[model samples]
Target: MGINDDASAGQAPHADALAAGNVLNALPPGYRLQEYSLDGVLGYGGFGITYLATDHNLKCNLAIKEYLPSDQAVRDGTFSLRPKSPGAAEIFHWGLSRFIEEARALATFNHPHIVRVLRFFESNNTAYMVMELIGGQPFGEWVKRKRPLSEADLLAVVRPILDGLAMIHASGFVHRDIKPGNIHMRTDTDPCLLDFGAARKLVSGKGGELTAIVTPGYAALEQYHSHGHQGPWTDLYSLAAVMYGVITGQRPIEAPARARNDPLPKAVAVGDRAIYSEVLLRAIDWGLAPAEEERPRSVQAFLQALPRADLMQPSSLPPATVRADSHSGFGTLDTALTTQLEAALARHLGPMASVLVRRHSKEHTTLGPLRAALANDIESETSRRTFLERTEGLLRGESPSRPPTTVPGSRAPVSRPPTAPPTTVPPMFDPQFLAAVEAELANHLGPLAAVLVRKSAAKARDRAELFLLLSDHIANTDQRRAFIRKSVAAFKDKG
Candidate 1:
C-alpha cells in the first residue's frame, strides 16, 4: 500500500470537482469524498481511469484505479438502440456483474509481481481501489528501448508473469487478455504483469457465457467464441502468446504455416536475433492452438510441455502418492490367466519388442537384411520402453531419496532422488529439457496423452510445459493441484 500521509485523510476535495463534473466528490452526505493527490494519470481504458496517487493512510505512493461502470458499448460502435435482442437487459446485467467481478478479482491479487490492493471502496458510480504503485515502464516501451531483451532478462521478467498467472488460476480465475501492452516492467527491469487478468467474476457465480471477450492478438479463440466454457487453458493460451511476442517480435498468430504440425501457433523462424530458444519457440506454437479441447488442459500441464534444459538435469519429480495400487482386484492370477493377460497387453500396447529381439538373436544369429531391420527397430523401441518403464518405476517409488542422476565417480546404485530442499529458490528454466520431458512423458503415459498437448505445448513457455508433463502422470485433478499448492506453500513458508 503506497499511500502517503497527505493523500489518505484530512485533505480538501479537488476544487475542480464541480467543473470536471466529478460525480464522486459529493459522494453521499455523511461519507466524505476522499482525495488521493494525483501525481499523474497513467492511462484510461474502456472500463475506468487509473491514476498514480500518494496515499496518506498507507504512507506511500500508490496506483489508484477507479473502476466506473463501462459505457464503452455506446462508443465502440457495437451495440445499437435500433432493436433489443433476446437478452438485452440480461446482457447489460451480466456485463455489470463482470465489471464488479473484475474489481473483486483485482482485490484478490496479493502477489509481489502483482499490484496490491490496499483499500477498496465504492462511491457514486465507481469503485475506488488503492494499490501499490510499481515503478516500471510498459513492456511495449521496454521493447522500444531495449529491443530484444537478453534471454536471462527475459526469464527474470517472464518467470514472474507465469507465476502470477498460475497464482490467479489456482484461485479459480483466468487472465484471458494477455499481451505486451498488458505487461509492465519497473525501471529496474523487473516485469510485472498488468491488465492481463480477466474481469469475469461479476457474472453468474455458476459461470455463464461471456458476450464479449479479450482482444484478438493475444486472446485465445475459445475465449471469444465458446459459450460458458471458460477454464484455465484459456489464460494458458493467452500467456503463451505473450511469451511468443516476447521471444519473437512478431505478434504470434494461431494458424500454422507448416514447418511442423503443432497445436498452437509456432513462432516464425526469425533466426538468431529471436529472443527465445527452439524449445520456447515450439512451446509458443502449441499454446496458440485455435481450439480449447485442442489446447493443454491445465496451467501445470502447460508448464511441463515448455521447452527446458532442466528436463535433462536430475530434478525432483512431484510426490508419487497416487499409484496403480489404487486399482482394486489385484489378486495374483492363475499361471494360465497370467499368460493370457500378458498376451492381451502385448497385442494392445504393441509387444515388448525386446522379447522378439532377444528371440531373434537366439533363433537366427546369422540372419541378415530383413531380420536385421526388424531386430533393429525392436531393439530401439525396447530401449525407449525400458527407459520409460524405469522412469515410471522411479515415479512410483515410495522412498523420497535423491532422483537418479549420472554423476562423476558415483558408485551408488541409481535410485530416485530425495525431495528438493524446501527453501524458496526459484526454478532454473530450460526450454529444451522441458520439450524432451514432454516427449518422454507423453510416451510413458499413453492414456493421458492429451495432458502433454495441454494448453500451448506447441507455444513454448518452458515452465508451463513442465506442469503439463506432470499433469499427464498424476491421477486426480484435485490431488495434482494440491501437490503444486503445497509446493508453493512450502516456498512461501520458507520465505
Candidate 2:
C-alpha cells in the first residue's frame, strides 16, 4: 500500500511501527537492504509492512513492502522473521510466495495509473518488494479535502482508474480490493491503483476458491464467499462502491448485508442531479448491483453505459483553466474523422486520448489544426512525431497513399502527378507498398512500425532512401540490417 504524505496525517516517522503492535518488528532507520536503506515505516497492515526507504544508488526515495504477515510471523531478536508456531510456518511461506508473485505480476505492467514495482528480493528470511513512492494523498483523504467535486472532476479521477483496472482484468487478475484507500492521488492529480495485496489471478476467467479477502462496502457479494465465482465484475463492483462513496459522501451498504435485505439506495436516487448527470449515476447504480451477473460484465460495458458526452460536459462544471486555449470556439466534429483521430491518438495516449481529443475538438474544427493541438499535448517528441506521421492523411483530408506510376528502368515506382490540382502530388509510394513495409517493420517494432514507416516515407525520395530512413528507428544493428535487406527484396518482388 502507498501511504503518501497526506495519507500519513501527521503521524510520526515510526508511527506505523507502534500501530503494528511492536517497534522492534520494524527495521530501524538506516537498516540497509542491498542498495536501499529503510528510513521509517510508511504504513502497516495485517499482511505486511511498507517502509519509506532511500535508494543509495538511485539517490531517490521509494517504498519497500516486506511480507510480515503479522498474524502468522513475528520479528525475532536478530531482526529476521520467524513463524509464531510450527503450523503457521506453512501458511507464512505460502503467503510470502503469493506476495512475491504479486510483485512480479505488477512489475510487468507499465501503465501510468498502476503503482510501479521496481524490484523485489528476499532478505532477513523474508521477501521485500521495492515500489515507486507516490508523493500525494490517498484517494480517501483527497476526496475529503476536495469534496463537492463536479461530475467532470470526479470522472477525471475515475476514468484513469477504470483504465488501469481494465488492464489488470485483461491480463487475468482481479484487484479484490478497490477501496478509496488503495487509490493514490498523485501530486499531478492523476489517480493510480495501489495495494495489490488482495489481487489474485483468475483461472479460466474465474478466481480460485480462496479465502475471502475484501473491504466491507467495496467488495462484491461474490467476494464474501470462500467458494464464490469471482471475476472482472467483482473488481467493477468495488470500483463502483468507491464512486458511490465519492458521490453520496457515505459508503454504500456492505455486500453481505445487501445480499440479504438489499436496502442500499440506488446512486441515481441519492446522488444530486444538479452535481452529477443521470447517466453517470445510473452507471454507478448498475455497477453496484448485488448480484455479479446483474452488474456490467467488463470495464468496456460499464464505460459504454456512461457515454462520453455525459462525462465530458464542461458547461456543468468549472472551466478547465489549464486547457483554456483549446476549450474555446466549440464546434461539431465529423463522426468518421473524430473516430479515426481518437483511434490514432489513443495509440499514443492510452484511455485518456478520447478525453483530450474531445476537449481539443471543441475548439478546432479542421483536422490539421486539431492534430497539431493534440500533438502538443504529447510530452515525448518521438511520440508526437509518430502521431503526426500516422495521421498525416487525416491532416490532408484523404488516404495516406495513391496509385503509383512505375519507372520504366528502375524497380522503384514514381509518384503520380495530381490531375485535380497542379499544386497537389500523389504519395511517393502506393498503399500496398506502405502496408507491406509496415507489416515487415511490425515484426520488430510492433504497432509503432506503421507510424515510423509513414514518417520515413515522407522524407524518402526513393525506395533505397525509404529503407535507409526506416532502419534508423530500429536500434538493434543486426535487426536494422536485416530489415533493410527484407524491405529491398520485397520491393523487387512488388516491381
Candidate 3:
C-alpha cells in the first residue's frame, strides 16, 4: 500500500508503528519513511529508527524502519561512514549515498532466516525500509523469557543464524556485531536469525572502521584489535558467545587472549545435560574462538557441524513454485481461460517442490515421487481482493485464497447467460473478474466443504457455489464439471 494506507487503516498500529500504512503510502513516489512505534521501540541505531508497523497491503504485521542520519549524522559531513546530515533537506541529499547504497545492498539478500525487505523509499529527510515483523523477543529478551534454550534447541537456533550469516558473508559483508540482541528466534520450532544493522561490505579492506566498534561479549578478540583485520570468522566468534549465553545461562565476556591453534571446535562442558549436548558444546567452542582465523571459515562449515535439521513449512512461507498438474493433464484452455495453471498443479508440484529450485539448483531437476505425494496446494486466486471493494459481503463469507464467482441471470448455462432482466436479477460469470470461480467455491466453504455445499443460498444472494455450478454447467464439458466435482470429492475425503 502507499503511504496513505500506512496511515489511515482504521486501528492505529502500535503507537510506534509508522502511523499505520498511511505514512508509508503518503510517501512521495520512490520515497518512504517508516517509524518504529510498532510493539514499542525495539531499539535504534546510528542509521535509522525502526518501528513495528501494520502493513495494510500485506494485511500482516510488519516492522517499518525509517533511515535518517542518527545523531551522528548531524555531526559528520559524509553520507555513509562518517556521514553528515546538513539539514532538513540536506539530510535527504547528505544521506542519499547511504540510503541508495543500503537499499541496493538489502535487495541482494533474500533468505528465510534473513529479514526480508518488503519495500523502500525516502522522503522528508528520511529513508524508509519496510521489513517483515517476526515473532518472539530478541535474544536478550529471549534469554529472560526461556532462561536459556535446551541444547538441541540451541543448536536449532545457532545453525540457521550461521546459515543466514553465511549468506551475508557470501555477499562479502560481515555482521560486525553478532550479539544476542541481533540474534532472534521464533518460539516453537525452526527458529531463524535477525538484524543486520552492523553488517558491513568488506570491499577494498575498508572495514577497518569496524575495528573501532564491536558487539560486547560476542565480539572476537580480533574485532577489538585495531591492528588485526577481521573477516567472517569474527561473526562466528560472536555467535559462539551467544550460544554460550543460551545454553550455559551466562554470557562469555571474552575469549582466551592466546587462542590455541586447534582450529576445529572442541567440546564445551556444561554442568546440566538437560541443557546441552557435547556436539553442541563443540560447535559453540569453535564459534567462540578468539581468532577469526580459528573459527569455521564459512557459514557452510558451521552448518555442516550442526545436526541435519530440516526446514519445515513456515506458518507464513509461500511456495514460490506453483503448479496445476492434477490427475488430468493440462489440456487446451477453455475458450476464455488459460491452461497454464490448473488445480492438478498442486498435486504435481507436490510438497517437496522447491519454489526456488530453478534458482538454486546447479542441475535442472524434475518433480520426484516424495515431492509429488506431498503436494503444496498453493492457490493463486484473488477473489476476495477483487470483490472486497464492490461488496465486502463476499469477503465475510469465504477465504481470501478462494477463487472468484458469479450470479447467474438464468438457469441455463451458456457463454452469454442472458443479461439480467432487471437490477433484481443477478448475472452469471463476470469474465471481467480476476479471481477464478473454482477456487472461490472451495474457499466459500471455509474447508468445511461437506456441510456447506448442500445448504443452498437464497436465490437472491450471490455466492461462490452458484457461480461455480453455472460456469461448469455453461462450459458444457465433463472436464469442466469434473474440476468442481473433484474438489467436492477431496473435501468429502477430508471429512
User: For residues 1-495, what per-residue lDDT tens digits would candidate 2 score against the true structure?
Assistant: 211222432112232323333543788878899999888877665667788888999898888888887778998888899999989898788777877887788789888998887888998888998888876667777777777877777777877888888899899888887777677777435988776766777766333665576666778888877688898899889889888988888888879899867999989899998788766787898899898888878876675455354235658555533222233232334656666665666555443344445545655666666777777766679978887777787645654232223332332211211111224343578888889889987776544566667877897655555665565555444565566546534563222
For model 3, the stretches where C-alpha displacement exceeds 4 angstroms are 1-40, 54-61, 67-71, 75-99, 124-126, 143-148, 205-212, 225-228, 254-267, 270-275, 307-495
Q: Would you list the rank order by TM-score, best first?
A: 2, 1, 3
What lDDT does model 1 reach?
0.46
Error of 3 at 211 (Å): 7.0
| Candidate 1 vs 2: which has more lDDT | 2
- lDDT string for model 3 (133-161, tens) is 76654555555665544554555666667
Global Cα RMSD, each model: 17.3, 15.0, 21.6
Q: Which candidate wins on TM-score?
A: 2
Q: Write candidate 1's Cα lDDT for 1-495 as tens digits.
A: 111111111111122112212332212212222756655454444444555566655566666565433443221232122113444445544554565666666686788776565666654434566666665566665665665555555555666777777787777677665666556667544667664224454234555566455555666665555374777777777676666666656565433322145443346365244445554555555666666676677766665545332232122222223222222222221223222222222221232222222222322322222133232332246643543343232223322123333332221212211111223433554555445544544643332334444443554233322343354334343444443333222211120
What TM-score fits each model?
0.52, 0.62, 0.48
User: Top lDDT: which candidate number?
Assistant: 2
Tell me which of candidates 1 and 2 scores higher on TM-score. 2
